[model samples]
Target: MLKPILIQINPLDNVAIVVNDHGLEKQTVIEEYQLTLVDDVPQGHKVLLKALKKDEAIIRYGEIIGYANADLEAGRWVNESVTRMPEAPELDKLELATRPAQPLESLTGFTFKGYKNKDGSVGTKNILGITTSVNCVEGIVDYVVKIIERELLSKYPNVDGVVGLNHLYGCGVAIDAPAAIVPIRTIHNLALNPNFGGEIMVVSLGCEKMQPERLLNMTAENKRIALADEDIIQLQDERHHGFESMVAHILTVAEQHLEKLNQRQRETVDASHLVVGMQCGGSDAFSGVTSNPAVGFATDLIVRCGGTVMFSEVTEVRDGIHLLTPRAANEDVAKDLIREMQWYDDYLTAGKVDRSANTTPGNKKGGLNNIVEKAMGSIAKSGTSSIVEVLSPGQRPSKKGLIFAATPSSDFICGTQQMASGITVQVFTTGRGTPYGLAAVPVIKMASRNNIANRWYDLIDISAGDIAVGKKTIEDVGWELFEMILRVASGEQQTWSDRWGIHNSLAVFNPAPVT
Candidate 1:
């Protein structure tokens, strides 16, 4: 028989979540708490510990997640329909640097095999990236990509793969607006990603607002890339006569980059060279108790080893900004964190919505009550490290430690932005389940429940589910993740997503106008 279990995160929490694989029925008793279920609660759903009058605060994680909408009885199910979300924390009144984080013990003597670049960046994969200046070239680029994978990739065994940086923001848009900087810089930085090995190439239509010169100039101005005119292939140039000519030109240029990439080999590098990005999607209530916390533990391990770690998703962190501001390393970083939060606040306001729109139906079905409840779980991926730096979308970090990269909550846009910021590997957590991956980097997928892990045996890379049932401690799974990251970074092991060839397309975050 399955053991009846209830997990209360904090002593002050007034509700507890069911932990059994199959939820307990009415009249079922949890001997530890000596409470009976008044209603049939599904697995991962919360149950009230005590009856409450209308408008009473509901607490979890020792923080007020919501208020009861009606007079709730003891042992009844508590979910989105019965909870009213609280207001977001005020940015201007937030405390800064109140409780700075102490330094963790140093972790040394750890290293991985990585490809080093002249710009001092290290890459976990060796790839040849063909950048596009306009969406007009996508079809051609897609056609050429298949040809490269089919005919060219086998010849260069050292080159991991070839990818075309495709997006929809090159034409029919306001190119000179201030907000345009976001998408423009994103494209420029995508080409400079460490995995591309300093070999920059671009495909441009003969006529477009975002010309190759303008696009590549951004990188040159930032001192990121230096390329000659030969590096760009202009389809409408007089040299190209027909469709065959363009395909031949692209293939020839691709071979040149591939040959250069093939010459590079992995060398021993310090673990500090690793730059990891952490994110979560399709979350359920178990997210906070299991997978996310385990990832947090690993985040601390990475920071201790002198590596760089980033956690992003602006709306997901907005509600919990107060808890984070105090952990900032200094006043400047704290202010920067607030600046990003404020920017997102205004952006959401302009769209006539608020952070409450962040919660998906899947999230509610998986047991989350509102955005307030979801934000608390989402921020756990950052671990407890002090915020050493804050980065705008697509901006790389100068200091090494935990960083908050301001980005939208969409999974594809977040992954793209993190890649633009120079992440060579990513750790993703999910409870409701998603098959998300990025082609430029290897993503390590983790499941928050045993049932999902058991069902998606081949898809999930790690299972933090055991932490919920007392089979393992957070430290145990955390240490396991740390070791796995090293192996994956060294190219000694392949994540399931990489092995199965599952990858999502790049989705750039464009808050700018499209006129």
Candidate 2:
């Protein structure tokens, strides 16, 4: 039995969030807040604790999320319609590196079993990745993949699985544009991900703008072999007489990569070898109150253990830009953070839209008032580590720590960028519910409420709902997630997403011109 509870995120906040889905009854006693409700508060929604004039700022997480659209009194429902977005902070005026995080003394001695690559990176899954230069040969790749799974994969017992890096950016677009680097580099990097065990194979459609050689690392021999020509199987090759020929050619090449991956074995590695990407989607008010904060705790634990963690989604963090700058590792990092923020701002402006447009109808119904409120919660997935590094979209990390990889708020696109940056595992927190996953990595889904957990028991991997129900503390759930990452990383456990093979397609962020 659970009672409708009010959650005050910050003492300075003028609003409190409803914790239970059914909401509280009018005049019901809330023992924690020491106040009775004047009206029924819906689950995950906010309740105003004080009167505000039009234009007065609405504070949550101890920062301004928005301004009042009209005068409102205490006990009123402060929904999205009544709050107007405030102007984003000027980039030049943000403070830099004010809250340098102290070294963690609590989490030490943490490690996970992973495969060590020749390039010095570590991988959680030993997989054979098949890369493609265009979408034209997708059906052929899918058909070949099914055959490989049914006929060839059984022989290579050590290889986890095979994934085809199918995406929409290879052809039918302006390939020579300055922004073309975004997709080209993205596909190139996706093949080089640690999980592939350094074996690269490509299937080219013969005449696509993105050639197989272009998607590989260039050698200085005047020849355009990226991964290696011998490893590439072009569909238009003169030797391929028919579709079956192409399929036969692909299977032969795949068997070779599988042999290499099958020989690699998991070994104990320092947590430093682990790079993780964290994101939130289908969010609700309890997302910040429960799952995100608990993820923050787990993030801190990972950082303290000498691991690298990436938190992203530019629009989700733009409203709380001021809070992030001061905690950046240095002035350069703070400025870099501002650059991504400004880029996203201009991007939206170019489209005649703004940050407020990011909040979906599902978001508003789930109790989030606006993007600002969402930002305050979304940024929580980063935990309290100093922003050690900042990266542009499609870039991989040169050093380890807490990195903020700039990416769009779209779940699939962000996950794709995270994979590009070398994250072998992902922890996705959801409130309204989403089945987002990536073929390049194992994603551990954390639900924000018990009701959602109970309803989608098989789909969700872990439940942060206990934090909201007060059955478990944030530390309890955080440690649980941390341990789960190791088990899934070590191949000892499989996430529901992995079991169901529910991977979403790669969505490379193309902010530049498409024509």
Best by TM-score: 1
lDDT of 2 at 360: 90
Q: Which number leads on lDDT?
A: 1
Q: Residues 231-296, candidate 1, lDDT per residue (tens digit)?
A: 899999999999889989999999999999999999999999999999999999999999999999
Considering summed lDDT, which 10 consecutive residues are worst modelled in model 1? 219-228
RMSD of 1: 1.1
Q: Estimate candidate 2's alpha-carbon lDDT, on a 0 to 1 scale.
A: 0.86
Superposition error at 415 for model 1 (Å) = 0.3
Q: Residue by residue across 268-384, what tens digits does model 2's lDDT show? A: 998878899999999998899889989999999888888899999999999888989998989999999999999888889999999889999888888997888899899889899
